[model samples]
Target chain A: MQVNGVEIEDTFAEAFRMVGSRILITACSRQWALQAATTMTGFATSVIGCGCEAGLEREVEPEETPDGRPGTSVLLFAMSKKSLADQLIKRIGQCVMTSPTSACYNFLESSETVLVGGKLRYFGDGYQISKLLGGRRFWRIPVMEGEFLIEESFGVQEAVGGGNFLILGQDLESTLRATERAVAEIGKVRGVITPFPGGIVRSGSKVSSKYKFLRASSNTPYCPTIRSLVDSQLSEAVNCVLEIVIDGLEKTEVGEAMRVGIRAACLPGIVRISAGNYGGALGQYHFYLRDILGGTLG
Target chain B: MDKVILRLKERSNIPVEAEAICPDLFLTKSQQEIEELALYYGNKGRRLGDFFQVQGERSDNIVIEGEIPNFKKIGQGMSRGNIHIQGDVGMHLGALMKGGRILVEGNVSDWLGAEMEGGSIRVKGNAGHLVGAAYRGSSRGMRGGEIIVEGDGGSEVGELMRRGLIVIGGRAGDFVGAFLIAGTIVVLGPVGLRPGAGMKRGTIVAFQEPDLLPTFHYNCLCQLSFLRIYLHHLREEDLNIPQEYLGGFYKRYNGDTLELGKGEILVWAGQVA
Candidate 1:
């Protein structure tokens, strides 16, 4: 299959199960809200190195937030529930708690929950105040800037991580531009995030490496510089490649994101769109490129 | 969705122990069965049929229309469903209620919503003393749920409250939020004397200048973001919150130094400030 002259690979993107949570951080102003969100999600790009993966989901309007202030929604993903909770407690305590006039709330209401403010209330020493409103409990901790209000707990559920697609272009500039467009489009969807810096990954990797210490190595088959030296998957026309990775709250959202991103990446000078996988050996979720593009899976 | 309406046939001078008139009691019984239910008039055990006229079938929704100023325990220990009272109600209107909602269209007597664990109570008129307060020896009061008073409230409102919210739209009498352990009390009107006394941890927000207790020390004056969220929640409950208060700063006083000294009293600074 092809879209806008870009060939669609027949393979699928393999995604592993992850535990994720969404947090809403509202502040005195939009700038402060974005500041806190960016700080909290910073350095969280991949579980392999960062211990977690997170990104800003969207900017929320004043009326949409719990505190009637401009806010931002962020999603954090980890390989296990324990790590997700740990990362959330550390990041929110250091980043959001220090932010001026900021408050945190659980964005999801699932039955499965993780302790957030319930545990962080220890920061207040013996001064923490708990208020129950509308059946939801919030903890108000005294801070230097006045008080920080956060929900007692946050909902957690199984999510899909490592959903990715490669954008192959004739040259570097075209590849970068197409990947940028794809990231911009995927950012519009809810319940998904591109954890990589600027929402694009240049070092697409294969399953394992020759070096015993490395679990993953660069994708040699798609590397243009060594295309002639190895069994290359790229055609002679393809020169540069950039991958856009997606982590979403559900498989359907990941599929939807992939569909939208692939369509947007199929722009001028783009040669093909392919997905990464371990040859169906690992990961429970298989997002077929054709099925996503053909609207067969929701 | 069944609705049972009980209209008053006569004004009972003697207080009636009407604890059996809750939604759970009428949810499964027929009108005749409900009428035959036992009740106490002072010291006499009489059938409910001797008092107000009963109508409708078994339902989770109950309506009581009467001059029932002497009716007690109107919704005691109610776990689920809704009760609408059209006139004055006696003491213990929703004592120890765990769930559901109670809407009082007229005045309510003392101990309204006392020791309530969960559910909501909205009073369209005045409420007597100890609304949402614990009993004299109880450790906690109104652990969860909400109580919104649209009119004046008598003394000791929210005393010893451990959790939940109490919103008084009109004047509040003395000892408001006294000995509050935790939770929030938002008084939209003038507050009486010694508010937040002995409070260990909680928030007392008053629109008018409360009769500040000597134990409270001036903390700071600033805009609180959480107040917006709390007031916004109240607005969702159909409480008429002044728009100016939502955007204005508050004069915070950290008080009850005699206790844990963690509680706060936020007095509205008004639009001019």
Candidate 2:
């Protein structure tokens, strides 16, 4: 299948099951809210190296937030529930709690919960105050700026991670531009995050590496410089490739993000759009490229 | 959604115990069976049909109309369903209620939501003393739920409350939130003498400056984000919340140092910060 002039590969993107959580941070101003969100989600690009994957999901208006302040919503993904909980506790305690005039609230309400403020209340050193309002408990810890209010617990649920699509172009600049457009479009989708820096990954990985210590290596087949030496998957016309990786709260959101991103990436100078998969051998979720382009995946 | 209406027929001054007339208890019973149920008229045990005119089939929705200043324990210990009181009610109006809702269109006497565990009570008019307060011997009062009083409140409101919220749209009398363990009480009007006295851990937010006791020490002034969240919740409940209050700063006072000293009183500073 083809969209706008770009060929759509028939392969699917394999995504692993992950545990995810959404956090809402509200502050005295929009600038501070964005600051805390950016800091909390920083350095969280890939689970392989960053311990977790996280990104800013969206900016929230005052009326939409629990504390009636300008807020930002962030999504974080981890391979296991325990790790996700640990990451949330550590990141929130260090990043959000330390920010000025900021408060944290759980963006989702689920039966499965992790202790966010419940465990961080120890920072108060016996001076914390707990208030129960509308059936949700919130802890108020005194800080230099005043006090920080945070919900006692955060809800977590199973999610899909590593939903990606590759943008192949005739040159480096064209491929980078297409990837940038795809990332801009994906940012509009809620409940999904493009975890890589600037929402684009240049070093797309293969399943394993020759070094026994490494679990993944660069995708040699798609590397233009090494294409002639390796079993190349790229055509002679394709010179550069950039991948957009996505993780979301659900498979439907991830699929929708892929669909939106792929459509946006199919611009001028883009040769083809393909996805990475382990030949259906590892991951449980499969996002077929044709199904996404044909509007069949929901 | 069957509604059972009970209108006062007798004009006796003696208070009647209508604890057993709750929606959960009357939902499954026939109207005749409900009327025949035993209730206390002052010190004497009498059938409910003897004092009130019972109408409609029994259901989870109950309506009590007429001048009922003598009706006590109107929805005591009720776990679920809805209750509507059209006029003034006596004491213990919704004591120990766990779930569901109660709407009072008129004034309510003392002990409005004493020891309530869950559910909500909305009073359209003034409420007497001890709203959401613990009983004389109980350790905790109004463990969960909410109480919204659209009119004035009497003294010692929210006394020893453990958890929950009480929002008063009108002035509240003296000793509001006294001995409060943990909870939130927001008064949108002027608060009477010595509010938040002896409160161990709780919050008292007043629109007008309250008469603070000597135990409360003045703290720094700042905007409280939690109040905005709480006001938003009240707005969702259809309360007429003042927009200016949502963005204003408040003068914080930490005390009842005589007790645990964790409680705080926030007086609206009128957009000062």
Candidate 3:
């Protein structure tokens, strides 16, 4: 199958099952809310190194927020429930609580929960006030600027991570442009986030590395400069490649994101749209490129 | 669900203790069984059928229609269901209610929702003294739940309240939230003297300037995000809240130093101190 003359690989993108949580960060203004959200999601790109994968999901309107303030919605995913809880407490307590005029709330509704503000209340040193309203408990911790309000618990549930598609283009400029367009289209999809810098990962890695200590290494087959020295997957005309990784609260959302992203990335000079996988093993979810574009499961 | 309605047949001068009028009790009883429920009329044993005419029954949804100004403890200790009162009710309405809702279309007398563990009580008319307050000897008042009074409230509202929210859309009488352990009381109109007296840890928000006690110390003038969240909740509850009140800065005053001194009274900075 081809989209805008770009070949759609028959292969599938492998994704692992994980746990995720959504946090709504509201502040005195949109700038402050974004500031806190960006800071909290910083250094969180891949769970292998950062212990979690996080990114800004979207900007929330003032009326949609709990405190009626401009807000930002962020999604974070981890390998286990405990890891997600630990990452939440550390990031929210350090990044959001420290930001001026910011309040954090549990944006997800699920049966399973993790204690967030209930534990962060220690920062108040016995001065924190607990408010139970409409069956939801919130903690008000006194800070230097003012009080930092946060919900007692955040809901967590099973999620899908590492949903991806690789953009193979004729040159660096074409590949980068196509990937940017794909990321912009993916941004409009809900419940998914591209947990990478500018939503584009240039150094897509393989499962194994040459170094014994390193569990994974760069995807040499997709590297344009080292094509002659490695088992390159590119053609004579292809010189650049970029990948967009997605993490979503559900498998269907991940599939939808990949579908939209691939459609947007099929510009001129784009060679093919492919996905990374380990022979359909290791991951629980797989998104078949041609099947997804054909509106059916492979 | 068929509602159990009790309409007053005759206006009684003597106060009737109607603790058995709770929805939890009437939930499984038939109309006849509900009418047979016992009551004390001025220390005299009487049947609920003696004064009020019972209608549909065996439902948690109850509707009481009449000027029951002499009836007390209407929904005392109720765990679940809904009670709708169309006329004025006497004292101790919804006291000790655990879960459910009570809607009073007319005025309610003293001790409304006293020591209620859970549930919600909405009074459209004015309320009598000690609303959501603990009994004279009890250490805690309303442990959980919510009480919203669209009209004025009597003195000592939410006294010794441990938890929950109390919103009075109009003026609150003296000593509002006095001896509060931990809770939130929002009075939209001017508060009476000595609000939050002896409160250990709680919040009393008064839109109008209040006559604060001597022990209270002014903290600072800043915008409280929690208050904004609370006001937004109140708006969802269909209360008429002004745009200014939702975003205005408040003058925080930590007070009742005679006790824990952790309690605070946030007076609206828009109003003159």
User: Which lDDT tens digits does candidate 3 get at residues B1-273?
Assistant: 689888889988899999999988998999999999999999999999998899997899999888998899999999999999999999999999999999999999999999999999999999999999999899899999999999999999999999999999999999999999998999998899899999999999988889899999998988878899999999999999898887888999997999999999998887323
Give lDDT tens digits, candidate 2, residues B1-273.
568988878666888888987878898899899989888988899998998799987588888878788889989999999999888888999899999899999999999999999999999999999999999988888899999999999999999999999999899999999898988999988899989888998899988888789999989888877888898999898889888888888899989999999999998898767
Question: What would the per-residue lDDT of candidate 1 be over residues B43-89, giving only the tens digit for each residue?
Answer: 99999889979999779799998879999998999999999998999
Q: Which numbered prediction scores highest in lDDT against the true structure?
A: 3
Order of candidate numbers by DockQ, starting with the best: 3, 2, 1
**B-chain TM-score, every candidate?**
0.97, 0.97, 0.97
Look at candidate 3 and give me any clashing residue pairs.
B98-B118
CAPRI class assigned to model 2? medium
lDDT of 3 by residue, A157-240 (tens): 999999999999998898999999999999999999999999999999999999999999999999999999999998888889
For candidate 3, the docking band is high
Interface root mean square deviation for model 3, in Å? 0.7
lDDT of 2 by residue, A191-224 (tens): 9999988999999999788899998999999999
DockQ of 3: 0.84
* Clashing residue pairs in candidate 2 (N, C-alpha, C atoms within 3 angstroms): none
TM-score for each model: 0.97, 0.98, 0.98
